[model samples]
Target: MTLYSRVRPLAFKLPAETAHDLGKRTLRAAQSTRPTRAALSYAYGYDHPALEVDLFGETFPNPVGVAAGFDKNAEMTHALAALGFGFVEIGTVTPYPQEGNDRPRLFRLREDRGMINRMGFNGQGMERVKERLEEDGTPGVPLGVNVGKMNSSTADEAIEDYRRVFDRLSPFADYVVVNVSCPNTPEEFDESSPEHLERIFETLAAENDADVPILVKIGPDSPEESILELVDIVRELGVDGIVATNTSTTREGLESPEREEWGGLSGKPIADRSTAVIRAIAEHTDGELPIVGVGGVDSAESAYEKIRAGASLVQLYTGFIYGGPSTAKRINRGLAALLQRDGFSSVEDAVGADLELE
Candidate 1:
């Protein structure tokens, strides 16, 4: 069995957040030097020509990326890259550091192969993340910065919060994601309302002198009509792309006892719904707008479904936790085989293949 598979049982014994911190520490150690990083690259990294994807004016070595929450403080981007992820998105970072929700906020739904978290955007903030990026340098692959406002910020204050973080971190980001759909955060205001979103996009767009591509993260629980309206707003604002989903609030078919936990649901249970959202957005945009599909992505089949539904790229967090260090290599290899099997030359060619058929 794989090393992580062997150790996972022990890891699971710890609180989910604690285990995550331990894992991140291990990854940080693994990336401490050039030789160790090279060793990791030799052992885990995999590449194939067919896996390349061009999105948002950047060339992703492959379409599989580590979603934001995983490297919240930008602590392990190089390590994750060595583990075979094509790109790594860090943060949900705010303008200043903040302690999030109380402890025991993250849980693993073992039986369902899913996770629930109410992290509330706990992060080291933008300055620390930017400093780390400057110190360690960006990873080999593309880097995305997911920016968010402080949990306590009001609707008006939220705009400045986003702009401040974006202004600080965008230089280090290949693209930036404005996260407005996190279910774990305070709901004092309609963060996803078109007016709020417009204000956010306008504020950030003005600060984006570098013209860094700006994308928005949306949650899965929203109705298709509402999602489409948000998509239209994004398009009108000249936003760069969309991360198709964040996490689900509904616990529809979960079997794990942790299902009762109050947090955003992710992984297997949300797979079909996430794909449906991707398909809906793809159809609505007629494949014109770029989409970075996320939610419940754990295997090549799951990632491929999003691609065919019109995702230019895909990201995973819980998948990496369960599937272990080699998740990206395994998925990317499987994707290349699937691409050849389907007669597609590359991932770009395969995007929206099924959407056209519909």
Candidate 2:
């Protein structure tokens, strides 16, 4: 009864952005070639070695990624890394093409599994996602890029639109988020203001010069003291992590009548408020920065409860549009059997292990 749960009831009868542009044109034609991307990596690859994960400097063969608006213009990064995504963030990408927010603006709360787009940062930008990542290359795992800023940019032209999509996709990024908390764009300023996130982390830490790794996506309806004052202005601008959440205008316990669709609000009713904003930014950065969590991820006990509430990594787009393609090999083989049933040997020794039982 799989096969995308029997074709997701005929792709949930279209118009959720046209069944997400016909599932990214069938993952851009099953990643065009190479024996059908090695027959989708021998039918949905799922590596184990306790699902390895190092973090932004690469080495994430697991940590269940695939977040940024589901392949927005970087068209199916190697068919979502041959469907067992261990990384694949694409874009909010802006610095040119946009045409967003109209035509039924994506909605399908299918009895609250959730989804209510308002895709205002619509893509096909950043030089066509940097010429489709220099003609289909960057995916053998880690690839994030989420950069955004052009819903009629202001606030000083949104810092040169995130310095022109992080100077054209940060050399095909292994890390680079910087999406000022999208609630479906256009608020005309104060994009998480602390002086506009310190002029967007001091202009992307001075155009980063290949120091890449520069995360920051935040948004779960704020107030945890304004999200710890934007995580102390993202740890006083040395920024290199934090993507806790980025979709939710909050519809409160929605039962789904497209719950007054305005925008944002991603899967499974924003899973426990995006794991309580990744356990309040991992108990206020005591776990020392780096988070990546993402809202209401789909399985492995909700991505092992945001890697035990500190999320060394996690991401999902409406649970791979309702757990299809063996949803990251069934959530990284149930997160390596829930990290060896909790004795934990890897996944970075179970991230925060429920914040050392508080």
Candidate 3:
């Protein structure tokens, strides 16, 4: 294991929220020209004949991406991209900035190799994030902005909350991710129902005259029935894609001393379940729509499983924490090898290959 991975345990010991900030602040301070950034790019970057694929009209150099909630602000977009993610999704940013929940809102289940966060959409406002993107001299890779509502906002006013961010972040975002899955927010978990989903998706998609790809990130806690219902509504509205699934509400299999801490659970525990949900969405959408899988992915085998199960693209955040900077590059490299061994010409051909297994 690399030194980065070795040091993670030390960071993981602190309060989850505090450690997250320290890591983000550390990354944020490392400018684009920092040697760490350059070394990260060189060590993690990978390319091949079949690695390139287009999602939501944007061409990604590779399939592995950094999931949102990792970089809540836009500060690290280019730097993370420079770190070798094919795409780096920033935010879960609200219309206005939010303090999120109080201290001890985040937890780490080390025994389960997972994390739970009730962070409640803490972030700088969309305008500031957009402003940061505007000021960056370097043009990074494709970026997806995950927009969420303020902690105090009700579900009834969620659209206006989402709209304000989309309006400002559109120019810099290759796609806009409508993040309605945040379990920490007051009504967020229940808001992913068929009717609420339809309203939020249709409203966001309507606001974009440029055909900007609008997608929703759904929680992993919902029933399969609810997921299928969401698929039907999204398909009918021509929603571009879905990010399935988000952190879970369940706290199953947690042996971590901090297991009882309240937050949305993510990482190893949700790996299988998230991919299964992706498979379900793939079946429901019949591969017509894109699905970006984002549950527990710490290896290429996990990532390949997502692709085979039906994710056109895959993302990671917790996996990065567990595996360190080399994680994305490692997954991309292993995916290429898996494709070769499976006799698939490209990753796209393997998409939904696990559907039969499903």
User: TM-score of each candidate?
Assistant: 0.98, 0.35, 0.94
Error of 3 at 51 (Å): 1.7
* Candidate 3 residue lDDT tens string, 1-358: 6878788879867776777788778777765566877766777678776878777777888888999989888777766776668898889878777888787777777789898888887788887787788887334678888888877767778868887888888777888888877778886445666777777766777778877888888878778988888778877877788999889989776788777877788999999899989988888777778999999998989999999999999999888887876787788889899999999998888999878542
Candidate 1 vs. true structure, TM-score: 0.98
Q: Find the candidate with the highest lDDT and give its number.
A: 1
lDDT of 1 by residue, 1-358 (tens): 8998899999999999999999999999999899999999998999898898887778899999999899999999999999999999999899999899999899999999999999999998888998999999979899999999999898888998998998889999999998988999989899888888889888987888888999989889988999999899889989889997898999987899999999999998898999999999999989988999999899999999999999999999999999999899899999999999999999999999999643
Question: Considering only N, C-alpha and C atoms within 3 Å, which residue pairs clash in candidate 3?
Answer: none
Off-target runs (Cα >4 Å) in candidate 2 are: 1-30, 33-38, 47-63, 66-72, 81-83, 95-147, 150-156, 159-192, 195-227, 231-280, 285-306, 312-334, 343-352, 356-358
Who wins the TM-score comparison?
1
How does candidate 3 score on lDDT? 0.82
